[model samples]
Target: MGYVPITPFRRTAEAVCVQRARVQSAPAPLPVVSKWDILSELTEARAAFGLSDRDISVLRALVSFHPGTDLGADPAKLVVFPSNASICTRLNGMPDSTMRRHLAALVASGLITRRDSPNGKRYMRRSRGTATAFGFDLSPLPRRFAEIAEAAEAQRSLQEEIAALRETLSLMRRDLLGLLESLPEECQDAALTLSEDTRRLLRRKAGLPELRQREAELSMALTHVPPAEVISTEEMSTNAAEYEQHYQSLKKESSDSEDDPSWYPMQSDIPGSENALAKKKAEAIPPRIALRTVMSACPSLNDYAEGPIRSWSDLVRTAEGLRPMMGICRASWEETKRHMGQIEAAIVMAAMLERFEEIKSPGAYMRGLSQKAARNGFSAMPMVLALLRREGTAQYSPGRAA
Candidate 1:
């Protein structure tokens, strides 16, 4: 030999040795394929194939060194013969150590194979009338094209499912917020389960199965919540205007009186909700319900009030003071006052206070009712009457005098 330059040595991995034997013994006969197209599919499904960005980059550089764009011209034939330095240059000056590491990764993944020469160098040889090539064979790539493409398509479908589930969860979250108060007190277990599932999605990259399971659980939880109340924009706007009128009429009145139309919105002033079940015509509110009845229905007033709770004004004042204590926010309290009129809002509060131990969140309770008032005619009489039945007190006949 004239001269042989010193070169770095690398131990042949047993896995690589096994792969080389497999390729020689029974290479998966495959049709010639576009190298770039195979690379594109590999890139899309890299994660599923246990490939990293650097690994793909090294493979890309190796593919570039191949003689043509197509692979599998001859399954047993060698592919590229570029040196380490040349491949590194194509990879934007990646260090030799990094290139070698990623090259090993590609080999282990079976996307490419190493074809080392007798002296561990990559080159071609010619003997008399025959020629042989050796470097990194890309035949393995086209052989596994169908597998890789299938993985890519599956990944795409998984991503789509995740996006769709996220949208559904988002809508459910909005519904939960709107119906927070309206749900029956018994729905806590379902709500809690849904909360935990949603929290997981927010915190991690949950898989498709995980997401679908959560969605199913949330759907079941939602079943416990009241029927979906779809309030239209026009209806909400009309309700808002009607509330404004109630406030104006209250402002115009010198004193609270049952005769005032503002105090009790007529059956016609309130429209039925969109739900057929909620479409039943609302009965006219009694012109006069006694302060004594409210007191009998809610005895807790003695605890929250400083002095004797006498008039509707005194009840309103006491309820206002107790609003903060019950954890009801200003916005909720004000909306309730405006929508239901001061006396009704006050009675609702007193009823809630008596059952405060049973009620979890008073603020949400007030908001749920306020939302109901917008969609339909919500009256405090029902709430008060429910309490009277619980207390075993004589029912306040709506036809009786003030």
Candidate 2:
């Protein structure tokens, strides 16, 4: 036999198996830092603000246990951190001197803010909902802070715009439906069921009464009466001979009557008259409805058209061009106007809403959350004091005066 040797394919197969086994045995990488970790650390320091250790423990437990109750209307759905007393009530403890100091340190570090209420002040924390979407980069602290402030402002403005847009779109749909309802009652049912807008229009224009009524009238007219006679196929053939003889006798009588000119009738003179008078009446068309479809979609400031026609005039021209193209009927123009008026009212409403919401908005919450995260994840006190307190060149922490 020829010299036998191990195939290269066998070696490759063994290597592949070993590699996959090694990969499967390897452990997964550790998870990235999350908001919960930062929150936990913030809660732990509640006592530094004059809250008791027990109060701090209670707060930690509430957020961990009942996250939903703490979160109110916030989109981020972050739970508000409870106060020392609330914490004590929840976890069963009393306030202490060091609790307030811890909270002050947390505040100083920019981890959390002391929120004021009609009742009193309490610490607030933000959930990760808003922050994770925006990745945190600390390289340019000053620039980042400025960007964050601007982004927060933009978010507020966008929310107001979204609410207004929803209201206007809803009105436009309502008006479109109302126009379809004004057609003949015959067409009203099908019009209501029609999905193709053009088909619905044609049906309304055709002026047919409801399909069911038409069907009923046809049914009554077609109702059957008892037959005068009945015959089998062979019997009908024999009867045809008899019927022809009878038909000729009747025809002879009609032929004699036809000689009298008075008995004949002209084609034009009939019960239902077709004339020029009716033709003129049919020619007239309904007046064209002039619709005003206001482009209630408020163009963003970035998208706001710029020029000499820079004001609402530019927007009006844009609206004029879009209206006819969209085929909105004039009957709904009033509704469109109402929609625009409502939107303007909403903008004013939003401004008022914002004033009250500012204290509880995600931006403010995130501002506190960012500070908290910065405090826990990194040391801002050293950096902040370094900038404020210069020791030779490097500023150190501003130590308490003994």
Candidate 3:
């Protein structure tokens, strides 16, 4: 501790001396920790500590000169007395000035401490029964391991929370976009303005605070959304007739389509199920796409199906089996089928299975798609094609899918 320089933390060395005296008088030897493991934790928590890569690199080179990976029982051994040239060589020919600057950064971050000898040199002096090594001391690393680990863990949790929020916001944005598209063009309103603002905001990447604010604004806007337009009696009767005609056609396709107990939402077998399904039901346009086309896009669904999904009913059956596995409850699935048609529901289920990992709440997601379908008809082809594009199976375009 000879020729020590005066600094803001000059008392730090005094405190270290007191701690060392206590450590020397302890009943047991100090526990050793892996230097590399500490280095990795510090890497994650570097931003918190205001450390740079070059600072970490200097630390790395210093640690490598130690006998082994662990900072062991010998306290004096922790003081690495490497010359600047030796460290510079280890750092892939870094300039001496740059290395010195990074070393200062490490010292400022409390990851290391300077133990300069008389005349500002780094060396050890052997006395009668004791030795003193003057150099860069990494004893702080082992002492502050817990602090570094906590910082790293906090950073990790923050990243996870941000990721979850981003996904939630993205899902909400997609739903609002679909809803905006469903709105009547003649009706210009706040929802339209909000959608425009949302789109503009999305054009540039936003930070976490901005995202949170936008999410709240979008949620409030959605809650107060006005009805698309009021339908006259003639228009209502015409839409109702179309709904009935489509129901009849679906019934004709499979004799048990309406009566099937398995089809809970479309359970025309139950009294008044038709009224629940028919209310606000714009005519749903089913994507008459082939199973091979769907399978090529979503091969994961094949795992749930016992045999090949050769027909639309097979897809419905397969989707019914696959639905519960995705944490989607029966009631939500039933309502989705009620809002949209059965075939469209099955197609959505297939698309959901394809994107299982990315989607956090399959049930809520399906419900949003259902709401959009109820306002205007939901088309499954767009969802399917989007998935196909993501999977890089570009053979089937929108033109050919029709």
Candidate 4:
């Protein structure tokens, strides 16, 4: 017997050689499956093995050279003797230097083993129609198939959990914003602080534990809010009629004379009409002014709209779409519409959307507002005007034509 000498292009790492020997010596307990199947598993679990995209791409080229779809029953046939030229061509004209580095990476990762011939050239010798080859062997793929599949499944499960956590966080943010808008200014500072904290977590790509912690904090804040006062249906109707009558009286008085200073009589001028005056003032602002002020103050609302909000009707539609995202239950939303009318409810939703960052619980805040609207005490005019005043200039001054 003659001793055959072989030399490698580069010195093999001892750790890689050890791993390759271990894998090759291990019995094939797994079935001989298609190379594609093993590649799929490798791609999924690549991150766990510290494999990069280029490494996997090189592995894919190695698999393509296999004569059969299934790595043959004989372990020795797992070797593929494709020339470096063929590998570079399969890798989409990859540079020779780059191909060598990635091939070395594959060997170091223990996914493949080098079988260097005497001249370090890759080729197969046939003896009686059987390949006696020296090149890259893919036997490790079958040996590690079970481990790869398990790792892939775990990775998939983790991805699903992360996706679910993200969805929950989104709902929490929406609800918090809705609640913030509905809260009175006195209670808003705390909600705003919470909003900022939640935003920081989101920016950091927080995990489930952090998100849950923030959600619990927000829930606690909501529990401490004072309950909204409730009113019966009969009282709501009476108040609505009174409000309508007052508005009609003011409209008649204004149309009679444009220069009348008494269009909105002061509380001192009409002792018994204080509540009536407030109601009239609340409804007197034109919808256009309210819409412009809301659009300017709460520009975030435009993100929820499908098109440009060119009219009050468009603003209402955008608010309707955002209602559910804010965690306002259908029943509570309907109750608000019944008490305040659709336009009024929509206006309130826009304002809430505007101040959503400052509210703790949108659903609860909306419910509170609904209860007040049922008593004819909820007025969007004050809220809109307040936001406009905060801008240091009103878009339209009251009792003056633009």
lDDT, candidates in the order shown:
0.65, 0.31, 0.65, 0.65
Task: Give the per-residue lDDT of model 3 (tens digit) for 18-81.
Answer: 4553443333454588999999998888878999877888889999987778875676588888
lDDT of 1: 0.65
Candidate 3: worst 10 consecutive residues by lDDT? 393-402
Candidate 1 residue lDDT tens string, 5-31: 221136545754674546543635677
The 10-residue segment of model 2 with minimum total lDDT is 132-141
TM-score of each: 0.53, 0.17, 0.49, 0.53
Off by over 4 Å in 4: 1-9, 16-20, 26-30, 127-130, 181-187, 196-402
Model 3, CA-based lDDT: 0.65
Total residue pair clashes for candidate 4: 7
lDDT of 2 by residue, 1-402 (tens): 011111121223345434433342233332223334434443433333344454445335434432332222232223244445554555445454545554444333333322233234333333653322111111111212333345445644544554443333223223222333234445433432331222222223121234334334323322321134223445533332332232333433322321244323334324355533332332232111111111111222213234323433354444444433333223222222222222222222222122222222322221232233324431111221111111112211122110
Between prediction 1 and prediction 2, the one with superior lDDT is: 1
Candidate 4: tens digits of C-alpha lDDT, residues 1-402: 022222244664475476556556456555687789888988888988888888999999988987778864667678788888899999999998999898888877777777777777787787776666778878878877888899999877766666665555545544444455446656665765665455445545555577667778877766654567333446534443442333334432322332234323345424346654444454444442335545655677889899999877787688789988997766667657655656677777887776676665666666666667767546665554344333323221222211
- Model 3 collision count: 0
